[model samples]
Target: MDIAEINLQSRYVFRERISLMVLLCASSGRGFQVIPTSGMTLRSRSEHHLSNGDKYKDNVNALLLVATLVATVAFAAGFTVPGGFSSSPPNLGMAILANELDFCYFLLCNTLAMQCSVVAIVALIWAQLGDPELIHRAFHLALPSLFVALISMSAAFLFGVVATRRSHNNFLFNVVFNTVTAIFFHVMVLLLGPYVIPQLPGVPFL
Candidate 1:
């Protein structure tokens, strides 16, 4: 009578109907015929659900815009290193941080962020192409790629900050900067780890 009981009853009835349908299909010689129809019906329903919904389209477009922007920033960051580049003859216009370990870390993080953002953009574009299956796959790919891109961008930012001031002898500044970076990293992991980790493929459930 109540909503909970009603929901339970509805689910039970639905399961019963599905089992009965399966049984009938198996008993009939038209089992193969039923399978394609069921699959097509499911696909059609999914496509309609994704395409006909204005909210989904709007959300996807917003995400696409954000991902594209992040990708652009990351790509630009890769070309312009912290502290500028050396303009000397032998090392004409090479990054000044080229020899530093943190610079390498920054480059790796920035490159990863750029690559992941690009992938997320691609996935969003694919979702807009009106294929339900592709849309599903796109979400699976986009969410994780966007998560990684965000995390990597944060790392790149931290490393870039460190690389720029590494030559300074101000112990207090270094300590404060490192503390802030640590806090930022921890906050990001705490906020995003739960959502991103479980969604990743091949992760074993605890």
Candidate 2:
């Protein structure tokens, strides 16, 4: 081949390699569209864990869940009372149902609303950091709780697109409570201080 022809072929190969590297980096850097930053294939996998959408369909598990709720006064007042003999735990139900009129306030600040706020906070941070995959994975640590918080409250507020606090406790109260909690918990434990999450059985930090 002529010298010029050989030079042209080399340039083509170099450009092709550069293109592949760029694509790979883009995918790894952004993570996933779920957070508007997950552009890389590998990063997406890190954000979604197998536990994110697991089914809790076992009848015994369901029964235990309800029993636990009924026993909330006995259990979680201390935040760790499975034996029912522990000191009176904070009554989560009471916290949840301050007044029939104020029920939205309690649930929203405590559940779904709180969750959405958390996701938004993390999403903001993720975006701010130029969307790193590691940050996305750290955020995933709270994904399951965030999802439950939303569904539980949404179901409670059946007809209300969002609960509003005109005269009664509304959606906004909960939205702030839950969102702030999520952001704080996830960012503190997973993102900023992963080592802080306790390895104990029922601790809630993680």
Candidate 3:
């Protein structure tokens, strides 16, 4: 080939190689120059982030609903009481079972459930504000409070049932109460097992 033709071909090939290197560096993300992402990539990343945020909001909303429901139930139970209100002159407006140990326990547990549920509801409301730091803090507070509320509500239910029957020593009642207590504990252990038993080396965290 003529010298001019050879030089022209070499320049074209060199330009092609340089262009390929620039593309390779950009794709590998190790280039000296910072390459701006394409419009499609940025858009996809934004959509993915938005989807994740939406999912987080949905979860918070569901938890808020649960907390609100628990709070409402507990509050209503406090006013309704286990054995109704006394209409007598000496103990007017007091609970009929106020002196009973089971009724006292029921009231205590109901109070705890109501308080915890209120705390959870407040925290979850704050979580709805969309601040990442606040959301993290609110989640930590709300989840534990919600768990406590559930446990306390179960305890209150058990105590209320016992107080209503007025016979703790009945064989059938005893058997049913023990069975329910056992089931409650069993469910709790199962719920907590994944967090407790997955610390071993080859065990995956749930």
Model 3 CA lDDT for position 46: 32
TM-scores for all predictions: 0.69, 0.25, 0.67
**Per model, how many backbone clashes are there?**
0, 17, 0
Candidate 1, lDDT over the whole model: 0.67
Q: Positional deviation of 59 in candidate 1, in angstroms?
A: 2.1
The candidate, 2 or 3, that scores higher on TM-score is 3
Worst 10 residues of 3 by lDDT: 34-43
| Model 2 C-alpha lDDT per residue in residues 1-206, reported as the tens digit of each score | 12222232212243443343344434445432222111111232332443331221132233334323423422222232112232345753333223344344434434444445355345434433433444445344433333444344434443132333344466776787678756756654443232112122222322
Per residue, candidate 1 scores C-alpha lDDT tens digits across 75-165 of 9998888879898978899998899888899999999999999999999998887665676567667766887999899899888888887
Candidate that scores best on TM-score? 1
Residue 73: error of model 3 in Å? 0.2
lDDT of 3 by residue, 1-206 (tens): 12222232212243443343344333445324321111101112233334443435876898899999999999999999988999987999988998999899999999999999999999988888875556656766777678778878989998898899966579997997889898986797566332122122222221
Q: In candidate 1, which residue ranges exceed 4 Å CA deviation? A: 1-55, 166-169, 199-206
Backbone clash pairs in model 1 (N, Cα, C under 3 Å; residues 3+ apart or in different chains), count: 0
Query: Would you list the C-alpha lDDT of every candidate in the order shown?
Result: 0.67, 0.36, 0.66
lDDT: which is higher, 2 or 3? 3
